[model samples]
Target: MTSRKEHALKRRDLAVNKLTSLGDRIIDDVAKQTVPAIRVPSRGTSNIVYDEDRRYYVLGDRYGQRSLGNVKQIKKIGQMVYMANFCKGLVQTGKTATLREMYYVSEGWDIDFGDQQESNIVGEDLEVTLGITREDLGLMPEEDGASVYGDITLKDDDVEINAMRMGKSGYTISPTIDEVELLDHNVERVIAVETMGMFHRMVQENAYKKFNTLIVGLKGQAARATRRFLKRVNEELGLPVYICNDGDPWGFHIAMVIISGSAKLAHVNHELATPNAKFLGVTASDIVNYDLPTDPLKDIDVLRLKELYKDPRYRDEFWKVEIKKMLKIGKKAEQQSFSKYGLEYVVDTYIPEKLDAL
Candidate 1:
């Protein structure tokens, strides 16, 4: 029942167990496996601060105990000890002297030296393993949902139904229905809705059950990944995708992430590509037809639109037209702006109508 605070205080008061006494045997075992002749080095004359400042050794074990909780003092001593131990370990191990070699050698726990040599050795790979590898480790496994981490391998039989669409750069897919359930074995339509409000409204109106929609909110990289995955579905499974986003620069950017890849994650094109997918709602031209809010369009949005208009990579007629039209209107319209039409507008008018038009 002891709280963290109580446990920490008790630990501080208790006799310190040196690392050598606690787990030195483990390190010795590792050394024996790797280097059977390994031997502990004897103390020698050194210029290290701890070695030179003999006052601490003379002051007994309680030398730095007075300032135990002083963060700055503790950090300073930690840095000196770390650097000395690292150099000594390197010399003894005869490992490579290169930066990358050193990087891999001394990883996992971080050591800060007051400079900006920040390196995360056990980085995303560890995260991926922890999040995704656990499920696959067990011999007799149980059914787990598609989680971010753990080992859940995908098999052909697992995919009940698949659809695909091909476009200029690649392809994309529509969400498949779960065929395992006998009565509910029909193919589902995968709809990409940028706004969560719009998604919620669509769900309330039974858009998923009616059209079998998989409402994905595509903000930033998720949009790009969705697009890339859609493209793959299109190419591999011949599925067509419909995009529903606001009629603005950022929305267009989100759609483009599916159609072509975002600049930052362009390398992910292999997974998702809906090159043939069509943009179906709230275009720059729609501004002229519909009433737009007078709030001056974001300056940065205008700037990005101009960049898109000029960029050769985004030379699609649709992109050029929309970007130029936004520059002309000088206004941005959100999916919520069309809320006056009500949720029925999205379900009865937008969803069915858009797909029929497509």
Candidate 2:
């Protein structure tokens, strides 16, 4: 009598032969145009001997199953097999399946190995599950490739660009503003300005003339660069930095950059952006205090604000006041939306008032 191991191997071979035969027939049919098309198996087809629930085929020491490739990977591998089988059947109708077909059959062995999402350290197949690097799918060669680090070193100018790339889903860094240009050691106050022209004008007008008020331009590359430079400034100068972005989702995101750091660039949180940076202007509270126009607020914004308010990581008294103000206003008032009256209003009232309070 055959040993159980021997029986398993024989069954495995038989199943492989059956799959091989089925693949060959499907290809032949496709080649002959007998059927409109052959749809590749998705998930896994039940093996006759394994029954529906077992979901595995006999291998040397155990059962086997199919690799549930991600939808895209499944299609790619399936199409290749379909084409090969079609051509092979045409060339040699009854010949034994080629090594290519055998390889796919063996690839299916991963199924019988008992590796699944519950037991697996990594997701079932990160490549397939998350649709990330193909190697994560276990389809790529096992050999390790070159390290991710490159020989390229970043210059001062490249930091913003690199940070932007790194922070694709989050806020951009602000440009660097020399505190010395604003004031000398006698500087006492810091102001976070949003617009470049306004910032430049404020600087030119000597708005920050006496105080060390930082006139940050929270728009474009300047803001992004400023975010990065702020780290160095804080470390070197031992001065407190403040934030002043427009009042909008984008603006909120910018503040979040300084306050919490972008998801991918979180490592640079303490290094680039300052967490304690206060929002000095254009807050939800400014709606009533500055008396600005309002836009119809969407539920999404309200929900997002609520979430932000609840976030223990970023929740602060300043944020609480702003969020409550927005809840009271029931609308949004972006600084850019403000007309000349609003702009002047900000320069005249908002800036002056906040400066006094600060």
> Which candidate number would show the highest TM-score if scored against the true structure?
1
Q: TM-score per candidate, in order?
A: 0.49, 0.45
Q: What is the C-alpha RMSD of each candidate to the true structure, in Å?
A: 19.3, 19.8
- C-alpha displacement of 104 in model 2, angstroms? 33
lDDT tens digits by residue: candidate 1, 307-327: 778754467687777777788
Residue-level lDDT tens digits of model 2 in 1-358:
5433344345334434443654676567668866423332222223112212222221122222232234534443443344333333422332233223434443554332122322221221221222222211122222211110101112232232221123212122222121112112334434555555555445444455434354445553223345545544454556566666667555676666665554433222333456555666577767666567777678888887777777544455877877777776787776654454644555555566766787
Q: Candidate 1 lDDT (Cα, whole model)?
A: 0.44
